[model samples]
Target: MSAPEIYEDGCPICKERLENGSDVVQIRQKGADGINAASVQRGDNVDVAAGCKAWLNEKFAPDLLETKQDVVDNMMLHLQNMDENLHKGHVGEPKSTIHQLELERLRFVLTSYLRSRLRKIEAYFPHLLDQQRNQTAEDPLRLSPDEYIFAEEYANNMSLYFRRVALRHMPTAQQKLDLSKTVAPPDLDAFVFLQVKDRQERVLIEEATDDQEEYVIDLEENSKHLMRYKPIAPLVSNGAVQLI
Candidate 1:
């Protein structure tokens, strides 16, 4: 038996007004597929895009595998202990609030990592995946043989993202620009105030230009101050500070 069809006229993509009522086709579903919560909040300071770029570059240089993996693993495992402590006596996999929070923390680390690589894929091959490319393949940067196809495919999938990033070409300036173009890198250039969620020591001063200064700022609980958004990206990424 065929079920009765219900018709609702509107744009399917965004649910706004339809440009042409007769041209659009609407599909009717049997059941609702909505969730109570759809998105997860990761910290602001954690620069996954930066992490991604580092990982990709390291991949090309096989000798640094051990050193790179250690740094990456340490960052991801930072929250796993708390996650385990929160689920100490469970026989089955725990689905408690603490477990969810821990999962989110790990997710943030991975999300940032992947995002950073995509940023590189964009810069290194700015026009490779474009539908209407302004630059040629030889004009832009080239990825290694192992990375070329993957970077192109990944960049294609994240096309819309390239549009939203505020400063796309800035990061590639560090590289030889005869070929490199920064694609949709996450911007960490903003200067702003932040409030410390907990007591933190040795926070890098936002205004310091020299990395060799041995300068570190301490923040007491609930303390607020001006800082560069990038220096505190790790803190924000891990939920240590609140934007003010």
Candidate 2:
């Protein structure tokens, strides 16, 4: 048997009347003959869309929730040890309180990461402008960035961001020979890339030089033991590292 259907209707931001434009989202049971016997579709506004639709997984899906719960579980394991040491009494520190605090901290970190990535993605990938626009309309609180416009709008409220990075690009044999002679190929350019995560993050410091321009790429250490990237091709070609 199919589950009962539900609907949620709200006035569009521009609509004071009953219907300026109404978005209809419905949840209906798939017929027995349907390929998937059990499935649901909800509206774009729904935390979980009830229907089969593209962007459903990205916008509203339970898979990420499951993964987040796994992270919370791992956090609790370390929090447990802290609690044992903090409370020396026979009645150990309250496990539930510690768990809740740890979960809250994890959620804050995850949300911040997602917001930063969403802004960067929107800035670099112009093709997503339409989707971002629709999302901003539906959810006014969504973190969408207008990099050019927002800079001026929030100019007084913003702080300058500066980074120093070290990057080494693997060069072709011929390019290496030119670089060795203090000459670099015209097509080659250098840039530093940083990836951020909970404990495991990478930082690269790089120097980019053009005929008339020289720039430094800034890299920071948020956590300890940043991985060192060996220049494999250059090292091998220059007989610095023996290749098997």
Candidate 3:
């Protein structure tokens, strides 16, 4: 998020001390001895009002500048934890090939999710700071900034399980059919197969019928291996196309 703008507070002493004009006034400064107050004598020739005004302005300006620095530090600290965790996930002793790929995938998923969510936050954060400062009626309908961040993190964590288990357990099956025909498999199966001609044109062909009995091949599901032979072009004929 872009840093919050700092607001400068009006000087207290200028408003309080110089409200009543005086040639000499007491200014307090603390030191080794507590409550070290001193009265600086000023002549009527000195424009004491302008000097007091400048002093108060100078004192408050640093405070206003420091507030912006504090906002930036706080934001950096908040994002730093996420960065450190993701970095640790990637760097370490060598792991098993499968385990390492899984870990990298998880890191990619989570970091991508965080970056996407942070982009949204950077867009909306100004309105949030305004709401906090203005003390307007809180909207019951909108998700707060904290709630939005939490929800995005939660979704990223949940998707890991979905990718690991649900996708891994996808079923594979083969069947033998009584007739020789090239068409889609029975509607009961999970997917449909296509034979790609060039990169663009695809010919929809049913899986080869099982030679043994009434069974049909699921070209789409079994085809995931990419190596096995179901010579698509070889199987093509007048009405039947090759099942590459």
Best by TM-score: 1
TM-score of each: 0.29, 0.21, 0.18
TM-score of 2: 0.21
> Given candidate 1, what's the lDDT at residue 210?
58
Candidate 3, residues 1-244, lDDT tens digits: the string is 8533211221111222332343232222211011111112211122222222222221222111001223223323423433444455445422222224333433443344334434433434333333344554643212345645554454445445555756446644323221113222222222213343222123333444665434334443223223222333222121132222
lDDT of each: 0.46, 0.28, 0.31
lDDT of 1 by residue, 1-244 (tens): 7654333443222233434555333332201010001111222123333344344433332111112343354445534543554456353432244245435645665655445544555554544334224536544223333345776566555554553453365566542332224444334565666778878988776445656555687889998877677677556545576654
Superposed by TM-score, candidate 1 places the C-alpha of residue 58 at a distance from the truth, in angstroms, of: 27
- Residue 6 lDDT (model 3): 19
Stretches of candidate 1 off by over 4 Å are: 1-154, 157-184, 206-212
Better of 2 and 3 by lDDT: 3
Model 1 scores what on Cα lDDT? 0.46
Candidate 3, lDDT over the whole model? 0.31
Note each model's CA RMSD in angstroms: 19.8, 23.0, 32.0
- Global fold similarity of model 3 (TM-score): 0.18
* Rank by TM-score (best first): 1, 2, 3
lDDT of 2 by residue, 168-229 (tens): 23333422222112322112122212222223212122444565444333323242222222
